[model samples]
Target: MKQMREKRQPADGRRKSILSQLKEAADPIKGNDLAEEMQVSRQIIVQDISLLKAEGQPIIATSQGYLLLKKAQSHTITRIVACNHTVSQTADELTRIVNCGVTVLNVTVEHPLYGEITRSLMIRNQSDVRKFVKNLEKTGASLLSSLTDGVHLHELEADTAENLELAVQALKQAGYLL
Candidate 1:
């Protein structure tokens, strides 16, 4: 077996590089990948991410990986849709929204003890949807909506109001709107 390589970069320098990497990446960057690139352990990357977040970096951890949130364009439209559906309908709900050219930005559920808990999705297309569902299946993790009996909210964004309307209508037609 090969020995693990190590790089002795300072924590501050590593974090700056991490921020730069996230900014430059078009897609989310996995913490494991970041650790490998930085020659550090995944936990170190996680701690760095936490520190960055404490500094108000707008970083979000998605099912896919770590992403640095960007400001929405002036013309972008955003809306939050309340939805209730069984876990089985998750893929259908997400697919419908993405099919309408709306990006599923995140999901939020109200927890009895924790209040509002939101997670970033950043799902822009069917491929992202597939990966998201597959990861859930692969991990055997329950959806946050399960905590609220399949009731949750999705934050959606689109380039046009028409796209947002189409997505809302699709969810409504499916009896997912709450």
Candidate 2:
């Protein structure tokens, strides 16, 4: 395993390398891939990520992988909208928002003990929504809204204020806005 040590030696600078890689990626990078490239265990990559986050980097871990959340682009608008709906209404709620051409950046739910729990979504279109729903079915995981009795918040981003307004109106019409 001499060659393995030589490869892992590069990981001496891994934290910086990981940050650079995450910053350069347009999508989330898988932890397993990161660990393989660095010749280290996936747990090491997770620890490195924790340290990086502790250093104030805006790294977000999604169901897909890890992403670095940078500043909003020029002319982009972001709004945190409050929504209340049952689990069955999730697809409709997300579809309406995405149909307005807005990106669902994350979902937030308040927990009695944890205060606010936020998970990055990064869903941009119908296909993304479908994939998200499919994964949910495959995993059989409970929705976060189940924790707070169907109350949650979504951080939506759009290129225009009109789009955000449209999405909010749609959600309101669908009885999702609270």
Candidate 3:
């Protein structure tokens, strides 16, 4: 068996270029695909992605693939609807929002330097919510809701301001949001 020598990228830095490609992309790409495009082994691509993320790059790995999130739309109405619950009720609370046909765009938690660290969820259906929760358990990831005394903010998507208002009101009535 031969050891695969770790070849360093040249000054042009294909890895950085590849990282930029992912950052500028609208959608996620698989490691295999990125490897093919960059003319490197999939292992190298994985290492590159990890390094990019370690350097504070905003990258998300999902079942679909890896995505580079752009700055969220400022024009879009983003009301911070506060919800508090026991960890057990997390799934149902999310189900309520998605059932109303609104997309759960992101969840936010406070960080010392960043102030607020928000992860974009983009979940729009029951199935998506289910998968998300399931994977969270499978991966042993803690819920952000666990912080802030089981209180969290959901950034939901709606066509109009009226729709957004109704979604929050419904959540409030459901005792999910304040």
Candidate 4:
């Protein structure tokens, strides 16, 4: 396994170093810095990041570089739920959560390598969802539904069970949550 991976030329010595640098970084770290420290090409660092993310590492690439999300805590108060609906239903579902006074934190979809790839979206209102949907249309990027066949998970937050339950019921009644 190691030999096969070596052909991919992942920064073996640099993996740990990059990880260490990432640990101390409050924000994303640049690919070049990661490459220089590892004594490898920046392209190699990119590939290494791909490998790490594939292995279930919570790394996010921003314009600056890569930011490793702090893993979800076991005692998180928010609830993660899977819902299936048409692409057209995305906005209403998101708006429902916001209207019910909950913060829609993240959305997750399965990636071939990275298992569940989650994107943080701190959406809080109908306008936010509208803006998001507009951006999706603007980018010409397909929704996660295109990948998960209309199934997606939402990490939603509220102060109490009643609030969360209200949002869930609202989604179910709207034919969003199945």
Q: TM-score, each model?
A: 0.94, 0.88, 0.63, 0.57
Tens-place lDDT digits, model 3, residues 1-178: 1232345355248767877887777655778887776667888777887888888887776544577767767656656677788777878877877777677878877755657767677676888778878878798878876666777787888666776777777778878875
Candidate 3 local accuracy as lDDT?
0.73
What's the lDDT for residue 152 in model 4?
Answer: 83
Residue 5: error of model 1 in Å? 7.1
lDDT of each: 0.95, 0.91, 0.73, 0.77
User: Per-residue lDDT for 99-169 in model 1, tens only?
Assistant: 99999999999999999999889999999999999999999999999999999999999999999999999
The prediction achieving the highest lDDT against the true structure is 1
Instruction: Give the C-alpha lDDT of model 2.
Output: 0.91
lDDT by residue (tens digit), candidate 2, 1-178: 8888876745448999999999899878889999998988999999999998999999988867899988877999999999999888888999999999999999999999999999899988998788788888899999998999999999999999999999999999999999
Off by over 4 Å in 3: 1-47, 50-65, 69-76, 111-115
Clash count for candidate 1 is 0
Candidate 4, superposed: residue stretches over 4 Å from native: 1-76, 112-114
For all candidates, the clash counts are 0, 0, 0, 0
Q: What shift in Å separates residue 116 of candidate 3 from its native position after superposition?
A: 3.1
Residue 38 lDDT in candidate 1: 87
Evaluated against the true structure, the overall lDDT of model 4 is 0.77
RMSD each, Å: 2.0, 1.9, 5.0, 8.1
